[model samples]
Target: MSKTNQVKEDTKSVFQNKGSRRNFLKYSGAGIATAGILLMGCEDNENMVPDLDGVVNLGSGDVGVLNYAYVLEQLEAAFYINVVTNLYRNISDVERTMMEDLRNHEVAHRDFLKAALGSNAIGELTFDFSSVNFNNRESVLATAKVFEDLGVAAYNGAGKLLQNPDFLLIAGKIVSVEARHAAAIRSILDSDPKSFAGNDVIDANGLDRAFEPAMVLNAASTFILNKINASQLPTS
Candidate 1:
C-alpha cells in the first residue's frame, strides 16, 4: 500500500476505536441514569427532593437525615479515594493500609445511606477538592481531620432531628465508625489518643458537639465545589 494510504488507514482505525469508546461510555452512563430513576420510583415522594443539584437536597424528616448522611459520606469517600490515587511520598505501608481501610469504610457508609434512603435518596454529589494539596501530607491529613470531625458533629447534630428510631440507630452506628477513623488519623499526627476528640469536638459537659443542619452544611459547602441548597432540610 502507498505510504499516504497507510497513514490514512491508521488514522481511520484510531478514529473508529475512539468512537467505540465514546459510545460505550455514553451507553453506560445512560444505563446508570435509568437505574437511578427506577430506584427513586420506589420511595415516598414526600421524603424525596423535588429537585436535585450537584449536591443532595434532603427534603425533611427521616429522608432528610439520610440525605444528610449521604452527603457527608460522599465527601469522605471522595477524599480518601483522592488520597489513594495521589499517594504522598514517603508514606508508610501501614499508613497506606489504614487509609485504604478508611476508604472502604467511607464507601460502605455511602452505599448504606443510599440503600436505606431507597427512592427518597438524593442524587450523586460533585466534590471539589481544589484547596486540598494531595502532594502534601500535612494538607491531606488536615483536610481529612476536618472531614472526620465534621462527620462526627454532623451525626451528633442531626441525631435529634431524626424522627425514626431506626434511623437514629443507624446514625449512631455510622458516627462511631467515623470517630474511630478520626482517632486513627489523629494518631498519625500525634501520640495522644484523644487529640482529635478534645474540647473542640467534645464540649465541657462531655457531650459531643452538635450543629444544626445549616451550620454543618455551611462548613461543608466550603470544601464542596457543587453548592448544595439544603434549605429544604427540616429544622424542626
Candidate 2:
C-alpha cells in the first residue's frame, strides 16, 4: 500500500483506541440544555424573526460582516449537529465526545451571531449534503476539517473589512476558537497528534490561511442551498 493509504489505516486504529466518551465528557460539560439556553428569548423577540426563505442579501457595513460570519457559523453548527445525531459506524466514545464538544462550540458561535445580528440576521439557510458520506468516519472528519479551516480563514480575511472595533474583536476571538477546532480535527485524522496545525494550512511565514469572502462562499456553495449574493459587502 502507498504511504497515504498506510496513514489512513493507522488513523483508523488510533481513532478507535483513543477516543472514548468519558474522556470528551470532561470538557465543557455543556449539553443540550446549554444549547437551548443560548437560543432563549429568541422566539419571543420580534427582531429575531428570520428573513425570507429565498436568496437573501447580506446588507453592507458591519452588519453585513456579522451576517457573513453568521451564515458560516450556521453551516458549521448544523453540520456538527447532524454528525452528532447520525454518527458514523464504529465511532468510539471518545470521538463521540469530541464531536459533541464541537457541536456545542459551533452552536454557541451560531447563536451568538443570531442574537447579535437580531433583525439584521438573514433567515436560516437550507443545505445539501448529497456529496458527503456521513456514514464514513474519514469522510465526515475530512468535511469537518474543511469547514473549520474555511471558518478561520473567512474570519482572518474579513478583519480588514469590519469597521467596528468591537465586531473585529469578537471576530478575532471566534476565529481563534475556529482555529483550535481545525487543529483538533487535523490531529485526529492522523497518527501524529502534533500534526494539529500542519504545513498544509500554515504557510512558510507561519500564518494561517485566509480567503476572500467571494471565494469562501463559492467553495461553501457545494453544501449550502442558498444563492449567497455577497455583492453588497463593503470593499474599502
- Give per-candidate clash totals: 0, 5
Which residue pairs in candidate 1 have backbone atoms (N, alpha carbon, C) closer than 3 angstroms, thus clashing? Answer: none
Evaluate model 2: give its TM-score.
0.77
* Per-residue lDDT of candidate 1, residues 159-211 (tens digit): 88877665676678778878888878887976676786677677888887777
Residue-level lDDT tens digits of model 2 in 1-236: 96545533432232132656344222222322232222222333332223445767777777777788888998998999899999999999989988988997787677767655655678898988777788999999999989999999999999999876656766887898789899889888877866787787889999998888998999999999988877778776
Give model 1's TM-score versus the native structure: 0.77
lDDT by candidate, in order shown? 0.72, 0.75
Every model's TM-score:
0.77, 0.77
The reply for model 1, stretches above 4 Å from the true place, is 1-43, 52-56, 191-194
Pairs of residues at least 3 apart in sequence or in different chains that clash in candidate 2: 19-94, 20-93, 20-94, 21-93, 21-94
